[model samples]
Target: MEISKGQSPHTQPNMRTAKVYTALESLLCVNCKQQQIIQNCESFLKLDAQLRNKRARELKVCLNCLRGGHFLSNCNSRSTYKKCHRKHHTLIHLEVNKANETIPIPQQIVNENTITNTSNQTNSTTNLSSSTLNAQTLLSTAMVKVNDTEHNSHQIRVLLDSAFQSNFVSEGLFVPQISSALPTHTFNRNAIEIPPNIKLADPRFNESRPIDVLLGAGIFWSLLSVGQVKVNQLILQRSKLGWLISGELVNQRFISDQTRASFFSLNELDHKLERFWQVDEFTSNDHILTNDEEYCEEYFRKTTTRDEAGKFIVKIPFKASVHNKLGNSYDVALARLKNLERRFETNPVLQENYIKFMQEYQRLNHMSNIENNNDNAFYLPHHAIIRESSETTKLRVVFDGSCKLETGLSINEAQFTGPTLQNDIFSIIARFRLHQYVFTADVEKMYRMVWVHPEHRRYQRILWRETTNDEICTYELNTVTYGTTSAPYLAIRCLIQIALDNQDYYPLESQVIKEDVEYSQEYSSLPSLDMSQ
Candidate 1:
C-alpha cells in the first residue's frame, strides 16, 4: 500500500482493502508517546542517539561529594566524604591542572593506620597518601616496620634528636612544673638592714700582709680597681653563693674591709685623731701656724745647747755659715737681674732694644773682671773662714764664694747626691739671696753636724783615739769629711731634709738663681754686698 506525501500514516487508506489499512494504523498510534509512526521514526532515532552521547561525557559520582550522580554534585557515596570540612580531615584526592591539561585520578585516599599495618607485610604494594601521615606513621614507615616486635631505645632517641633538630627552644623560656600539686613559696618583699660592725674576708687581704702581705695586697687592690685584674670572675662562681654577694654582705665588704684594710687605714686614723683633738678638720692656716711655732721651739733649743767648757755652741761652723750667707746674698742679686732680663725678652716693646743693651752690659762687666785680675795681679780672696769654737775647742768653718765660681761643676762632683738634697739646699739659699737678706749663723762643728751611721762610725777616727795615751779622745774623720773633696756632695744631700721640712726658708727659685750666677755674666752687674768680706 502506497501513502500520499505529507499524509498521516494513522489516516492512510487500506492496504488489502480497508482491513489492512486498519491494522497498520493501529501499529503506529498517534497519541502513544513511546511508539512512532514510520514517517516520524527517523527524527526520534536521531534524538535518542544524541541524548546517549551527552550522558556518556558527564562525570561519575565523586566519592568525595556523595550527593550528585555526575561529578561531585551527582556523587552517591555518603561514607567516603564524611566530615570533609573538619580541621583534622585528611585530603587524599587532588586534581592538578597543568598548562590547560586535565590530569585524571591524581591521588588516592587511604587510612593512615591501614597503611601502617599493610606496610609491614608488603613494603611496595601499599598505595598510601602522604597528607594523612602522622608522627607515628612517619616513624613506622621510615624508621621501623610495624611488624617488628623489638625496637632499640637508641634508634628512638636518634629519631627524636633529628625531629627536634630544626626546632629551637629559647634559653629564657620557663617550663611550669606540673607533675605534682604543691604550694608555691613566695619570697619576702621587704628590704633588710645590716649592722656596721660586721667583717668580711677581703680577697685582697687574704692574699698576703704585715709588711710583705700589706705591700702585696696594696698592689693587688690597686691593680684590681683599675681593671688590670678581672676580680669579679676570679672570686665569684655561678651559683646561689654568688647571688648572696648581691646583698648586704657585699656592701659591708666594700665599706669596712676595703677602707680599714687597705692604704687608707693609717690615713683614716690620723684624720680621726686630728678631728678629735682640734674639734674640726685641719686647714692650711692651721698648718702654717703650727709650723711657725715648731720652728721657733727648735731654734731656741739649739741656741740653749752648750759644750763641756760651758760655752754656747752653734750648729753650723762659723766659716761655712758665713760663706753660705754671702753666697745666698750674691745669688739673690744675680737672680733679680736675670729675672728682669727674662721679663724684657718676653716683652713685645722692650725685647729688641733691651736685649742689645743687656748683651753690651754683660760684655763690659766680664772684660772689667778679667782685666783687673790679669793686669793688676789682683786675686779675689776666698772669703770663707775656719775657726775653733771657744767652748768645745772644735773646728768650725763657713762658706763664702760666688755660686758662679762653681760653674761647670756637677752636684755629684761638688756637694750633693739625690734629688731631695739638691732641691732643698738650692731652695734655702735662693730664698735668702732673693730677699737681699744676710744670714748670720755659725756651724758648731761642721763635721759634727752629721751623725755617722753606727756601722760607719769606725770610718771616723782621730790620732788621739788611735794612738795617744790621753784619756779624752777627739773625733776626726778618717773617711771624707764635710770639708774634704766629697763634703759638698754629702752636705747637699743632708741639706735636702732641712730644706723640705723648712720650705718657708727655702723658696722655689733657689736653683734658678744659682744657675744664673754660675752661667750668666749678665747677673754679675746686679747690686750685691757680701758681709762675709
Candidate 2:
C-alpha cells in the first residue's frame, strides 16, 4: 500500500501513468497545445499499454492466498472465473443487513430475447437521434485481416459497430478471389498523427474510403482488448484486427458542409446495393448491343486485319477524345511496383513466378523496351494473383488498367468497356456435356498472340524491374493487354472473324470455333474420335 501511494513516479509508475491519462482525456490535445511532437504522445501510449499489461499480471492476485503471508500475482491453485479462461477468480460479496433489508437482486433476469428487444429499442432511439446532428461523431473504423482462398490475410476496411447490431454486406462480397487491389482509393489525411510501432487496421484510416465490411455484435466485442489510448477527441482502441480509432477530428476542414451531406443512410445504401447487383459483367447476344459497343465493333472490323502470320492486329477503342488531358502516370505505376515488392518479400515463390511471367512476356516479343517516349502513353500498375487451383499457372500477373493516379485518369477510363460478346458460361457448359468425347484446351498466351496496332501500343506502356537492385524500365506492350476493358472483345472477335474467313474451306472447324470457343478457351464436345481429331 505504501509503495503504491509513493509521491514520486520513480517509486510507483502507475502514479505517473494516471497523471498522463488524466491529461490526455481532454477536449483538446495537450501535446499539440504545448507544441510538442505528437509522436511523443503515441510513444507514451505504447509505454502505457506495456505497463498495463505488466500490471495486469500483478492485478491477478491469488484469491486463496489473500489470508496468506506473502502476496503473489499467480499460484498453482485452480481457482478461476471459468468463463474468462484467465488464471484469476472474481469474488462477489453480498451483505445481509437487518431483517427489514432485502438482498440486492434484480427483479428479472435479462435473457437473450429481452436483450434483443432492448437492442431494437436502442437502434430505434439511435435512428431518431441521428436526424439532428449538432456535432459530428466519427464511428469506429478498422482494418480487419480476412483470409483469401489461398489462406492469405488481406487487410480489408471494416466498420467496428459499438452498437453490436447485425452485419450489413452485399451478397458475394466474401467470395475469395486470387487477388484484389488495395486502398481502392486514397483519401486525404487531415492533421492526423499516428504513433510509431502502432500498426493500424487501415493505414489510411483518416482518409475517406469506402467501407468494405461491417462487423456486428459478436465480432465487435471479440475484437476488443484491454489496451486503449486517447488523444483529445480521438480515441484508439487495440483489437484483434489492429488498432481502431474513433471520435471527432482536430481539424474542422476535414469535415465540411459539402462532405457532411455525402454520408449515406440505410436507404441510400440499399439503393447502391441494388445498383451493384444490376451492373452485369456479362453481355450476351440476348441483349442488343449499345451504341458505344456497336461503334467499337465497327471500329474493330474496319481497323482490324491479319498479318502474313495470320495474327490479328487490333487498335485500342478509345472513347474519350481528351487523350491530351491525361497526366504523367510513371510515378504512380512505380509506387505500385514498390508496393508489390514489399508484398513479394513474404512469398519468394510468387515473386519468381511474377518475374518469369514478365520475362516470358518480353521474350515472346509481346512487349518491347521503349527507346522513345510516346506523348499518349499510360503505364499500367501490375500485381500478382495466386490461383492454387489453376492447372496451367498458379501465379499470374494482374495489370491494373483501371488504376488511376491523382489525375483520375486510367486506361480503362479512357477506353470503352467493350460489350461481352461471348456466349453465356451456362451455354458453353451445356454444349460440352452433349458430345461423346469432350475435350478442353486453353490458347497458350492467346491475348499475347493477338498484336496491338502500332498506333495504339503507346497507350499500353508498363514499368517493370526483374530484380529489386535493377533499374525500372518502361516498355510498350505490343500485344492486346489482357487487363484493358476491350482486350477480351478484341481477342474473341478475332476468333469470330477467323471462323468467318475460313468458313467455306473448313466449314465444320470454323463453325466449332465460332460457336463453341469462348474467349480462346475451347470447351466443346465432339461425337466421335474422327470428328474430335
In the order shown, the candidates' Cα RMSDs to the true structure are: 42.0, 26.1
Q: Which lDDT values do the candidates have, in the order given?
A: 0.28, 0.66
**Per-residue lDDT tens digits of candidate 1, residues 1-533?**
45444434665544333222444443452323335542243432243323322322342323343112355444444445243342111222223332333222322232332322233432222332222111111110011112111111111110111222232211212322211110011122121231233222221222111110111222222222211111222221122111111111122212211111111124456667766765343222123324433443344345334346433322221122222222222233233334334444455344444334324423533112111112211111111122445454222221212223334321122222212112233333444466443433333333334443323222222211111232422232322243333344334433333434446665542332332221111121222455323
What is the TM-score of each predicted model, taking all chains together? 0.17, 0.56
User: What C-alpha lDDT, on a 0 to 100 scale, does residue 116 get in candidate 1?
Assistant: 28
Provide the global lDDT of candidate 2 against the true structure: 0.66
Clashes of each: 28, 0
- Tell me the deviation in Å of residue 488 in model 2: 1.0
Q: Across residues 485-533, which tens digit of lDDT does each residue of candidate 2 receive? A: 8888888888788888989999988877876787878988989999866
Candidate 2 TM-score to native: 0.56
- Local distance difference test, candidate 1: 0.28
lDDT of 1 at 187: 21
Runs in model 2 lying further than 4 Å from the true structure:
1-160, 165-287, 322-326, 372-374, 389-391
